[model samples]
Target chain A: MDKNLWRWIELNEYETPSVPTTMLAKRWWQKMLQTLRPSRVEVSTANSAEEEPKGVEFKFDEQPLLDSLNTLLDQQNQDDPRVTWLVLAPASPAWSVIRKWANQNGWQPVSMPQRDSLLTSSSVDELNIPSEPWVVDDLSHGFVRHPLGIRWLQNFLRKTLQTPQSPGLVICGSWLYYYLEKTHGGLNRQALTLRPFDTESMVTSRIAVSRAHAKRLVAVSEGHPGIAAAYRNAFAVAAEQTEIVLEMPQVPTAHGETSTFVIYALLLHGGLSTFLLGEVLNSIAPNLIEHSLNLLRSHGIVRYQDDQWSVTELGYPAAKQFLAQRDFNWTSC
Target chain B: MDTQKISDLFKTVDSNAALQVVTIILIAWLIVFLSQRLLPRLANLLHSKQRLYTLALIPLIRLVVVIVALVMLVPIFIEPTLKNMVAALGALGLAIGFAIKDYVSSLIAGVVAIHEMPYRPGDWVTIDGVYGEVTHIGLRTVELVTPDDTVVAMPHEKIWQHAVLNANNGGPSLMCVAEFFLTPESDGLVVKEALEQIALTSPYLQIHKPVVVTVNDEPWGTRYRLKAYPVDPRQQFKFITDLSLRGKQRLLDLKIEFAKVETAKVN
Candidate 1:
């Protein structure tokens, strides 16, 4: 199997084999991933010895969710004669573990030092580049917020972005985040206006609000409010295009070997839909609670700490409010 | 003649000594009282868990308070006795050192720990084979809770002696292993490419990225491991679990055969 292919399966490539045993394992894992979407995953492959991974090494970068995606498309990469990189995502805690494990194994030999970004990319432009301040902010505004910190990151990424410059592939929504649509991030400094838990539909609605602004609202006239709310459930409906095949019944792959696929489910009926040819759901335990947390971290809201979790700089206030609503009684009024 | 007896009684009292004893007692009491409110507040605002180190502030505070109070009250206790007091202190210095040897050493160690801040509350640390989250930082001892959830109180002297591993130095991020076994003939290059592709594609990947792809020395086949990160440090198991299971599934779909990795031996 190709190393990249192994990574696809190891990362659960969003789909699984249809055979009985593979299907059973897939379902079990899907259940786990569904329940723990935003949580870290440690797979134990030991046969006889039952030992947990050594306690964590502290300094990790993938605190937020969008950060992982933004990192995937970073500019600076190492030059490898033998290795071929098929894709790259934003750096996340999960990706870090994979890189370290791969290097230790000599699957990528020592002569090849991993290529890191020339400059540390700013989470803002990376997150904010997706048009609509509220759109990106709604995804990431929770974890980090500092002007110098944001600027330092921007200057760094702008430098790296200048290098290995490639025409970006603008899928359904990436265009908006990269400032293709409007002068976003004007009123708001941070990316992702709402908390990470907010749905893609909610983010789109806020994006419409920002895009309309005063002049656009004047142009839209009386239908402005309704037009803004139009995209509320658009992405969610589109997200269903993810043919999870929760029930893999008749996949045509090898026997006794697990198979993963990316089925192009519903075609573009009228609106836009983007699909990733993924191997598995990035998350393991995809429960409702974890779902929200996954959404939050994916958007760069909070972080994971030593055996515990907490909100990042931007998430502090909202998380505190959430705690008040979750732990304390704030509904009486 | 009765006045002579009263003067002799005054000599016995040793007013200066009385003053030092009273000052030490009062300062100690004041320090104990102030610490309850101060320590918790520092832990909260400062986001620290080193209560012992904070508590160490108490003794130092008390010492300062007593010294200041003594400096101001010296004239009242004894007249023109600075020189005489120094002579007296010199005379008793050796005797006092012999008596309070261990106590003085502990006091010094306590002082060093407070200023140095080797560990703090809410930090996961391992010392002398005992690993756990720090619950308290004491003057002479440090308390931590182990992963399986055991509370361990280790001496400060012990932590200083052995190698201490701090898990959450600034934030919690841990290295994770996602293992896969493939048929020995399976192109290691192909597998490496796919592994790299997965790491590149996964939304869980990070910038200060993890080192990846370790090929084992085993004969059954090659082992491809992706050391990736979780969205957060606390979620490492879930992160690695998803990556491993997914990576394996992807390879299988590619008609990849497998030699499952045997049980590892770590001696």
Candidate 2:
């Protein structure tokens, strides 16, 4: 009997039948252990022989996802112990998968404490956890407007990297990933973006769905797992009655003489500088053009950035509707 | 003098031939009506920048249909031979040319206009001091709609003796000029920049083209002229109006006063 086989059988909680006396039975037992040995020994575990396996292999429903994640972690562990894996994915199934996988593998998963919690809780208490391979979830929270939150996150990441006991870190969430990359240059971490299931996968997952419905699910969700799951749930209950309504913001009509011209110019050419916009509506008083632009900006129809003006996403549909209602012909310029 | 020869040279008129001639005329009329009506509708239906180009083809299509009808009718009414038709047309053209010399010249000019393409429908042109957009190019006359909404029919023969000023030629865009006059003391460089900015910001302004501001220090005041092209020729007036209004307001904002009317008139 191979010593490594006995270790895998013990780690996987597989029963080690008393060494078979017959040659055929012993060979069968060795072959079965050999098949499971590859999966169990791939990831290094520090489980002691006296410690009993708490859960069976088939207990968890997401066995395939767990297996894949274990393989990924094993590869990452072997490659570089210092590099953290930043997983960018929409919240829901992905976050759950990462949390479960980390927990099962005896790696600590920590989320960014809520803003209110952070204020009350001690930073030392949160950072000093008794586990290796910590997973930081939702690092983007409070980073947008909170300078203190950004400093705390940076400090935490720095401390985590210096700790020899902590093997690695996994950061989750798309916004958090983006915010971290933009703010902290990704902390020199490897990134993995988990995308929502495509149409073919969706069809394979759902037993009772037409191909068209699967396609519609993909479109409606825009490939966000959380949104797709919500849409699927809604579709399941009232398949025929379910309706997706896209509500477009309405653009107020340009009442002033030059307002129409200003809006039209913005619509024609997506972005323009203040100087260029003034030139387009030159017939209107410069004062009036300035006033109109300010008004449009206040209404959230247009945005000014870097000395250039552009209509907002909400402004496009509204402007189109407004222009169509007024019968403003672009053909006549 | 040779009556039998002339009679033989001409095909005898019959009911079937007459019906065929009437059918041809009807079809030609139908084509004319459709081209005049349907083409405009088609141009409207087509949501594209090339709508004007499509509209310009209407007159050409009408002209081709009429010519084709005439050609088709000639063989049915008269002997369809090159030599005979030339002899007949030669005599008829001589008498008609002498009687309507101006009409002949206009007709010939219209033909040349098609080939030369000096002006077409949707062009902004000035012929013999009349400035307007060409709405229709007829066989002998070209119809224009002025800014005042007045329709003027100018004969094609004017192309012979007068120079035609086509602002846009056959293209969709046309240049418009807006003038500003300010006191001599006002900064020339500042005013020029302001005028150029005014044109650059106009909604109807075509940014791809250049916006030029010219200044002249006249005795009356510094004359500032801003020249720019509008995206469409039809919007020339509106584009100019926009530029002028904004330019004036900008000048006011800069605390620049306009030249006195009496002084401007003197210049």
Candidate 3:
């Protein structure tokens, strides 16, 4: 029923929603006022989920996402041996819709190999390439930030682009896509992503939110549906209408460099286990890393779930704002 | 010139003009003080490019405010004539040149520094063998906060004789070099490749920039320089530390031996 709700486009074509000049001025004034007059530390509670709307609910429909995937497959030129479909999935919505679609369509899914095997593997045969179309669920998991850990990613990219292989789809996290675009530029040219939900789209959609609230949501979340949904849950619904709450967190405050980098690394990798996170930030002391993670966890900026620690969907908007303010490299979306 | 003509150079110094001068001074000082205090805070909140641009604006803003105050105040004190102005400046120069030649030179050099931009507020620079971040560019001296957090004030006149080595100039990309001296028995190619990886794998590295490893033959050992850039100039020290620590670890993992240098110990 939600078919064609979002159009799929090349990753390079995606854009963050533009903020209105008035809103930007208001935010700038707020920051200036805060600087001029110091205030008490803002505390955010993790139990805000209890404030969910009473009677109004919108369940996500998988039909549109599946149709978008079908369109991507149909658009691929089967005759061109050099072509490989690359998808950059956003960090929110823990599950992969593409993987589910692949399974439903009988397409095989490939999991990342162990980090050690990457260094020892010699050829493309190590991938055990299926004779049919395949989907690599999360390319972000293929490599570590360490020297020896990146070989698998290098080898996999070479196999996919250099040699003739089966038609395949590789899904990478948005942050990983940004990283790889800088590290490996050529693959960036062929990557695809789902279109962002701008103010117009949200207002026209089936969601019960008012137009004013939709604009604020788009402005804060930068058109990422998952992040928008996270913030949307904070809204109070009355007679099928969503009311905006002023208490929703605006931007997260990262106290120091350690906390900032921890948030950045988690976003870049989508999520990483505690051990892998430690390995990625080996320069930082173990105790400091644990402290920063705990601090961010309390702020709702990050959370540990499903064996991996990641920036929470609710905190993503604020975390992104924090990172952007500090001039950290970020995904375009 | 007659006494009447000499006195013509002076515009009437009424209470109104005095009040106007005070107002101008107060406003100008307020602007400069607030800008000096606030811009750095704002810059710290921003990312690389915006931060540098905001910081570099501080000196330029100060310069403009001072010049504007001078322009507004000069007319209140002197008659508007080429001859009067020249005669006034000549006498002032004579007294100032004799009394504070070094101070005046530093001031003029500060203006030139602003124009040449040898270093900006955020730039990491080494001047006259004193290395530090260019924290503030004052009228007579440039302030630097050294690596040890000591503030050093070097007169702007140093631009006349000393070489100003700017690491990042006014940009965020500062190249950090980690040097390694290995015994001649170690393989140069292997060390080179390993050093490259060490720099590449550094979390502090600016991935867009190229990571380079240069090898040289020294009498004591084979020297390797692994060079890369950090995302921010402020991260240069951390970047170098990470590179050095990890490079040594990786080299030792390869069983490479370090060249021992013997030097006399000083008390």
Candidate 4:
């Protein structure tokens, strides 16, 4: 057996060879076999009695969130049954956790169809959505706005609001949340934002770990469960190899005069023309702005396209953190 | 000093001592040359607000190296004894001091300039009537590159006679003013708010810094000046340009007109 397979089997407490396998373990075995065979390996499609569901298991603490959501739903059930509950969160482990929680609570979890699927259907009736209270997962994948998706959402909201005894709805994901928030004005009070675990919660959740290490994880991952889990896994493997703890990564400060200006400008304007940026930094010569932008580009912090300069995904967090440290709100910008 | 002692001081310069002195001079020159060539490139490559501070160190570093070289060469060119060196330096100083009074004064002023630091290599300054960015702070003269790309070498002796107006001092940020002339009949409140917004919305405006709008009623028109700081001193002109162009457009949008210009009478 491969070392990884052995470790997985041991970790999951499986019998050596004859134990009933889960869907995850069976899939892993199939992947290993395919890699080993390299030529004409047929994957068996037989269903097993002991197969587990094909969904990720979220291990983060979500009881408080569940309790809060239940309270909101109970209140709505009494007062306004037609209002749809908007559970706004970044698309990650939080979305998955909310979906799983809804499923466990007897609320039917419904995954949104892809953008292409929605586009192909002419009427909302053709899609055949369930009338029962449903939790919509992956509401906006890839953060790209689709007009059809917006139309479908608007239609659904209208139908739900028109019905006297409507099933309470739960919508998840950031881009969709932003779109709804902007276009649909009355949903703000009904929205429940799901945030990641705080520093104290993160520290207490782990067993036999130092508070310093837990704080390091929170700082590095920005309290995102998926990122924290990934870092933990990497740290475990590295610790096994080196038998030493890794030094914490140093966070970059936004104290640099020009850097602060560039980041602030990009955040406020979303993007800026080269000429306008040069004008904004008027004391700097045109050549210096080009040189500074080139350096920022090389660092993967800033990107230039169509004569406009903007911050990249990698740069956004650093910029946000930098601003936050200085008591400046990136959202306000 | 006696003639015999003066002759003896000259005779003390042996081949070995001469070689040491030459070697020190060469090393100092190389240090200066390489630093001059490399530091600016490094600073530019780094591309941060720290670039100005980094570039400023080059002149100071060169000065230190030269001073060290001269100190090392002093003993090699003459006798190593303190009494002999002091006597020789005193005699040489008297002759050079009288012969090159202005040069010596400037040299002493250069030392004071380094200590006082009225301007650095990257600072924007105005000395006498010339305004420019200081490119090099040399021993006797400061090299400034003007907005028109003219490099002027102004001697340090002028520091005694004239004030050096440093825009940014040693920092990276500098304030710029954008002035607009509107008809006296225009609403001051509306124009003031609009000008304030222009500064606030400017891409180059330093948000942490204050933006001020002041108005003065002139005989010709109402003069409105928007004073704001750019993120960097180098962006002063551009910042002013952005404010001016935008402020004028805003005034035009609000239906405000400029004051009519009066022709000057030539004598």
On TM-score, the candidate that comes out on top is: 3
How close to the true structure is residue B196 of candidate 1, measured as C-alpha lDDT?
54
| Model 1 bad stretches (over 4 Å) | A1-287, A290-333, B1-107, B171-186, B190-211, B214-225, B229-267
Native contacts matched by each model: 0.03, 0.12, 0.45, 0.05
Number of the predicted model whose DockQ against the real structure is largest: 3
- Which lDDT values do the candidates have, in the order given? 0.37, 0.59, 0.76, 0.59
Model 1 CA lDDT for position B229 = 49
TM-scores of all predicted structures: 0.38, 0.52, 0.88, 0.58
- Model 2: per-residue Cα lDDT at residue A301: 55
Model 3 misplaced regions, further than 4 Å = A1-3, A27-40, A45-57, A75-83, A91-95, A115-126, A203-205, A208-210, A238-243, A246-254, B1-23, B184-190, B260-267
Candidate 3 on B86-197: residue-level lDDT in tens?
A: 8788778897879989999999999999999999999999999999999999999999999999999999999999999999989888888999999988988878877877
- Candidate 1 chain A least-lDDT 10 residues: A261-270
Q: Candidate 3 falls in which docking quality class?
A: acceptable
Query: Is candidate 2 or 4 superior in TM-score?
Result: 4
lDDT of 4 by residue, A1-333 (tens): 111110101111211122123423743454344333433322121111112422342254566555555665665553345545454322234455566667776766554454444434254433234556655554443111222223455555565555535455555443334334433554443554434444554555551045555555555445544545544543442212433342222112222445656666554434567855655555445776676566556554567877778765334444554544333323311
TM-score of 4: 0.58
Model 2 spans > 4 angstroms off: A1-333, B1-5, B44-48, B261-267
In model 2 chain A, which range of ten residues has the least summed lDDT? A2-11
Which consecutive 10 residues in model 3 chain B have the weakest lDDT in total? B193-202
What number of backbone clashes does candidate 2 have, counting pairs of residues 3 or more apart or in separate chains? 21
